[model samples]
Target: MPSPSRVLKLIALLLDYPSPDVRAESLALHALIRTAELPEARRDGLAALLDALCQGDLLDVQERYDSLFERGRALSLLLFEHVHGESRDRGQAMVDLLERYSAAGLAIDANELPDYLPLYLEFLALGDAEAARQGLVEVAHILALLAQRLAQRESLYAQAFEALLALAGVAPELAGQCYQAQQEAVDDSLEALDRAWEETPVSFTDPAAGCPSASPRRQPAGVEQPLQWVAQPVPQTHPRATR
Candidate 1:
């Protein structure tokens, strides 16, 4: 067994190492911190450990993790060869902490996070549709806030829309009902806009009232002409329309 004083000294050294080098030292720190008998000692060591994790440089930032790992392991008995299993005490919690830490880091740049759809699709395969839907919605919300262009926003929206469609499949009638409700909402919005226009003074109406036939079309204040909306007749119903 390593001496308690030596372990405390090593912990201090580990805390001072650069962030990219932390992973290589994690197992050793965990072993030392767990073996320590004093609660204060353990607390201090774990706090340093968590800080190292949360503030670490990007996992693939330098694309030199393996090299850094070998170098750091050379200085301490980090036991890189040991196999951790689910039965190991605190193993699951440690794994969760690591994953959450990684996700939190990725989330810092709202737009740059990796494509999460593939992992989510895997989750859906396991029959966790609800969880998958929730994840997609969360991602969509993030993308909506970050997307600067219509193209990117549309891409992210499509993912959420597909998940929503999958959800709607579980309730077919509700899907149709929701579509009808959405259309009704749009119609109501247009009606309200028309009513508001009607309430405006006479001077506001002529500019809005001009038809395509109104020649040397009067340019209404703040309205651009050649007016963009030109009404065309709808063709009479025929077999060609069905085709």
Candidate 2:
């Protein structure tokens, strides 16, 4: 079983605006998901997303992508929007994130910002497993929010976000609504279930598996850098639940 990092990489592509190149790789992407060491449900949901991408007219698919993500701040692909909104702090946060990615050996194309979720995921995909999970956990609440909003809109894109939450090892069903993901409880049953699966974190794989949408920006691995700076600007996030 390949590491789940490939799933992260693929999910990044799934989340991005569809391109002809992306459409062309549909078959390979499906094969990759089919063989990933994921739970049946995760694999199925991902496959359904791929199906949505593949089975529809190209124009229709592109329109749907624009409708869900491009039209509003609610589902912005940039991670900071949910956290910083239009604040000045978002500017500094962007600089900090770019430096961290630079330290990781990934370059920022003039066309892309450092905080875009797919680009961020690509950086996580290139590194070791623990780092990737930490990257996801750092933004776990945002992922949940995106998942919840997408699911509410009945968008297949929700599957990609939900799959990311699973990889982050966040508790189930806390989609969006500004829920604090780390605060969610993982009871005995959930822990045992996790143990039963015992999956490893996503790590770098063969270079051939790279997704084309964002790969043009990747350089070689640089000195590994810690993202300690990617702090969660903790807000009034989650309500405490009583046991």
Q: What CA root-mean-square deviation does each model show from the true structure?
A: 29.4, 14.8
Q: What would the per-residue lDDT of candidate 1 be over residues 1-243, giving only the tens digit for each residue? A: 544333434432432223544566667665665555434533453545444454536564233322222221111111111111112333343334234434333222222111222222222222333433333232232222122121232322222222233332222232222111111121224455454223211111133543112112233222122112111111111110000
Cα-based RMSD of candidate 2 = 14.8
Error at 58, model 1, angstroms:
5.2
Worst 10 residues of 1 by lDDT: 234-243
Local distance difference test, candidate 2: 0.63
Residue pairs clashing in model 1 are: none
Cα TM-score of candidate 2: 0.72
Backbone Cα, N, C clashes tallied per candidate: 0, 3
